[model samples]
Target: MALLITDECINCDVCEPACPNEAISEGDDIYVIDPDLCTECVGHFDEPQCVVICPVDCIPHDPNHVETESDLMSKYKRITGK
Candidate 1:
């Protein structure tokens, strides 16, 4: 499943660069994740870089955008052409 930045985000700017898929970006009030491009790092790493690097632990799975591991892998392939 894609990850979402919660309101707890401090806008620390660490997550944007950590994302291999470039799924994170600066929003008006906080960083936002592009669910279409987010694969939870399935193709890039064993864990989501943003979640691992987050200082405030604001990154979490989006329940509204629920997806299985297979689904995440598919998204990763589509994003990376791998």
Candidate 2:
């Protein structure tokens, strides 16, 4: 599953660069995670970088956007051109 940023984010910009998939971005207020591009670091890292860097703990699993490991790998391949 992909992780999402909640409205509780403080826009501190700490989690943006930490994302291995570059999924996190500045929103109207809190940062937003692009579900289509998010891979939960399946093929890139051992864990979600955004979650590790987020100070407010706003990033959480997106239940509505559940995806399998294969799907996440395919998305990662598409994003990185790997």
Candidate 3:
């Protein structure tokens, strides 16, 4: 599944650099996770890097974009050649 940033974000800019997929980006006032790029760190890390580095716990799974591990793995492979 993709990760979405909630309004509770503290805007500390911590999660931005943590995303291995380069999915997270700074929005107008908070950070936003691009669904197209967010793979929940499936192919890169055992855990989601943004969720770990977020200070306010603003990151949450995007139910609208439910995806299986295999789907994410496919996406990761397509994006990074891994």
Candidate 2, after superposition: displacement of residue 57 in Å?
Answer: 1.2
Candidate that scores best on TM-score: 1
lDDT of each: 0.94, 0.88, 0.91
Q: Residue by residue across 1-82, what tens digits does model 2's lDDT show?
A: 8889988888898888988878888888778999988999989887888888777888899998999999999999999999
4-81: candidate 3 lDDT, tens digit per residue: 999998888888889999999989988899998999999889999999887777788999999999999999998898
> Candidate 1 — which residues are off by over 4 angstroms?
none
Q: What ranges in model 2 sit over 4 Å off?
A: none
Model 3 lowest lDDT segment of ten: 51-60
Candidate 3, residue 55: how far the Cα is off, in Å: 1.5
Residue 81: error of model 1 in Å? 0.9
| RMSD (Å) per prediction | 0.6, 1.0, 0.8
Model 3's TM-score against the true structure: 0.95
